[model samples]
Target: MKGYFQKKKMIEEIDKRIIRELQGDIPLEKSPFAVIAGRIGISEEELLKRAKSYLDKGYMRKFGAILLHREAGFKANGMGVWDVPAGDVQRVGEIMASFSEVSHCYERPSFADWPYNLFTMIHSESEDGCHEIAERISRATGIKRYKLLFSTKEFKKTSMEYF
Candidate 1:
């Protein structure tokens, strides 16, 4: 029983290390996984297997790239807030999220003063483009009561580290 607990602890530690390694920027190289595996003192195949296991076991929800929009020439971003009905939020959010211009879409709690419940992050090359994207989303969702809040400045943007 003591031996089993010790093995489990070691496994948990390795998983934590993997998560820590993954939380940072991935190497931009031909064999990025190989590089990461080498840092973790594991073979590339073993790293992939463990990563797959993490996904299969629901330990990790998703592994996806975070595009730096500014570097990619998407300079303007707008927070499109919609006053969507409670019953229609899910359907409308799906429609809004379908647009390539939209990067993030979710429903948030509405305040008495601020009734906009659904929000989407639309990105484009210019502020006008963002507004146009918001207009398209409004047309698709048929939710006319909306506003685009453009960012004046970005202080920081980074992914969360759970490890």
Candidate 2:
């Protein structure tokens, strides 16, 4: 029940601070790293090196935006869960991720009620597009059982500040 990123190398206090600073809007400046480095009491080169090292050592996933789907012209942010067999999870995940609309894909533990082990996010321009993605994924993976949980209400959305 643990995660993969627990054992990371060269992750220090400064690196944690750097991650915290990047959680929100990146400062608008000539040298973002330089500004961030100054605030975190580290050299820009050191900050950049640690960040790159984290990526190289698989400590951090791709760092980017937490976009507002509706504002970004994506009318639906559907959570597509699939009952991909254990042996086929990797291939099926890759196939799902290959779709133009799928934003993310990963494996998760399955429950009795929720037999889905593979999960993916499909942000589409419309509900029809999301359905199309679901249909294509079903055909591609040959897994007939899956569910598309679309967001009916904007309840809570925010970025987690990793400090």
Candidate 3:
């Protein structure tokens, strides 16, 4: 099967190198991109320009930071899944995504055994906090048929390396 990137515009060698550098751990410095550009033998301005170009051309969907929630006192991680009606999925998903506690929210295909169509990744300081956030989301959306699956252990959490 063809991957998503296989259908997108082909990138140059420099772009591949830039993506490789970007996929790795960015330096904890004042000018991280500058450091990356320096290593890649490109000016910081050019790096930013190309990155913005990628966004504009839909080569990249978004550029965002990966938060280390565990070290940041987010001890509880919950996956809140909702059985939303097909007609109301969009509206309810928007409401669920509005919650500050919710980090990620998206619609997924529902199965016969598992009827949840909406899923939200919630982070909190405690398990009770997660429950409270879920309850708030439920009240806001008025969708009571939901489940909060807490994470007991995280085996892996990493961004995809395109290059």
Candidate 4:
């Protein structure tokens, strides 16, 4: 908290302007940052530089979409953990990514007791749909050792507000 506050304090007036402008949707035109820069009376290069600086200083985690799964009819969300062998981890991960239901997949470190290493997030309209996708991934990867963890409650999701 102290570090974040200190960093927040370091932001200059121009950085605040950039942050405020970026809080809304960037333009969809060819040069979106250029348009933003023009609106803020700064060059495109400076806008890009300041944006990169903001990210490096941990002010922004990422610039990406925040999917509303519930609103999109994907009410069920499950994180499927697979205990894949070290040599087969990448291959299994690729196979898991082929499924549209698998929104996000990655290889994570495993603990001594918890050997699950490959984690894949499955989102669907129903729990059964998620389970079906997990089963399909397991069968396709030939790795039967896996578990699907379903969410018991839903929480609202939102992006950061740095105005």
Candidate 5:
């Protein structure tokens, strides 16, 4: 599917390099952009302008930190899948997204064995906390049929690096 921007050609080589560099850890300093600009052989003003332009043009979403949920005391990362009625998928998704506990929520195609169309990622301190959140979601959305799949093991968890 095409992205919101759908303007890949608008991104120049320098922008691609800047994006690649951003994929790594941004400096923890008063002037992080200056540090990045220095490394990329560009003026800080130009870097700031380009970054702002990216956001303005929908080339970039939001720039923010990716917290380590486990380290942050969120021990359980539950995938809550709901068998929401076909006509109410969008409404259910919006309701799910309104919950602070739900970091990600969207609609997905259902399979023969699996009947869930709406899914949410719930992070909490324990399995019980996850279940409580799920229950609350059920009460809010009026979707009784749901499943909470807690992660047994997280092989790898990191933000996608786009170069």
Candidate 6:
């Protein structure tokens, strides 16, 4: 713990220790930062600064809640797939990407049975809402042969801690 007093850069040992604490799920309490700080033998501010630095440096992606889509009253989320021609793929993908309801959009390898090359996820509070979004995109893009695969049943939606 000599480095604790020195304000030096994080060495391998300290870095490993910090990683160990982070790998485990943080204690549940009114003041979680205090719990973590106490366990790490550091001030809450220092721990927060280190965490913020990690987030700022892109070492940590987004830190937020991952709620179950079903519990949140989202009845259906459709994968709106499009078979846009190569010339309009980029344009249509960009347009599809602009919708706030569309959480993710990507290009996937097409199959003989499923000819869709591009896919956009439309998550909505209701099935009708999701369908509306899909229909709107279909009308906007002028692509008729798209598929809407909704969530039939959630087999798995669990959150795990990464240490």
Report lDDT (CA) for all predictions.
Answer: 0.87, 0.81, 0.89, 0.88, 0.88, 0.78
Please give each candidate's TM-score.
0.83, 0.80, 0.84, 0.65, 0.92, 0.72
Encode model 4's per-residue lDDT on 6-71: one tens digit a residue: 565875788889998987798889999999999999999999998998788777778777667788
In terms of TM-score, how similar is model 5 to the real structure? 0.92
Name the best candidate (by lDDT): 3
Error of 5 at 22 (Å): 1.6
Model 2, backbone clash pairs (residues 3+ apart or across chains), number: 0
**How would you encode candidate 3's per-residue C-alpha lDDT over 1-163 as one tens digit per residue?**
6644566656678999998887788898999999999999999999999989888977777777767888889999999999999999989988888888898999999999999999999989999999999999999999999999998887988788886
Which of the two candidates, 5 or 6, achieves a greater lDDT against the reference? Answer: 5
lDDT of 3: 0.89
RMSD of each: 5.3, 2.8, 2.6, 5.9, 1.6, 6.8
lDDT of 6 by residue, 61-138 (tens): 655555677788876789888888878888899889998889899988887787889999899988889888988888
Candidate 1 lDDT, 18-70, residue by residue in tens: 88898787899999989999999989998899889878866677887878888
Clashes of 1: 0
Per-prediction count of colliding residue pairs?
0, 0, 0, 0, 0, 1
| lDDT score at residue 156, model 5, on the 0-100 scale | 79
Error of 2 at 156 (Å): 1.6
Off by over 4 Å in 3: 1-10, 29-31, 55-65
Candidate 6, lDDT over the whole model: 0.78
Better of 2 and 5 by lDDT: 5
> Model 5: per-residue lDDT, tens digit, 1-163?
8664344456578988888877788899999999999999999999889888877876777777878777889899899999988898888899999999999998999998999998899989999999999999999989999999988987876778886
Off by over 4 Å in 5: 4-8
Worst 10 residues of 3 by lDDT: 2-11
Indicate the residue-level lDDT of 90 in model 5. 82
For candidate 3, what is the TM-score? Answer: 0.84
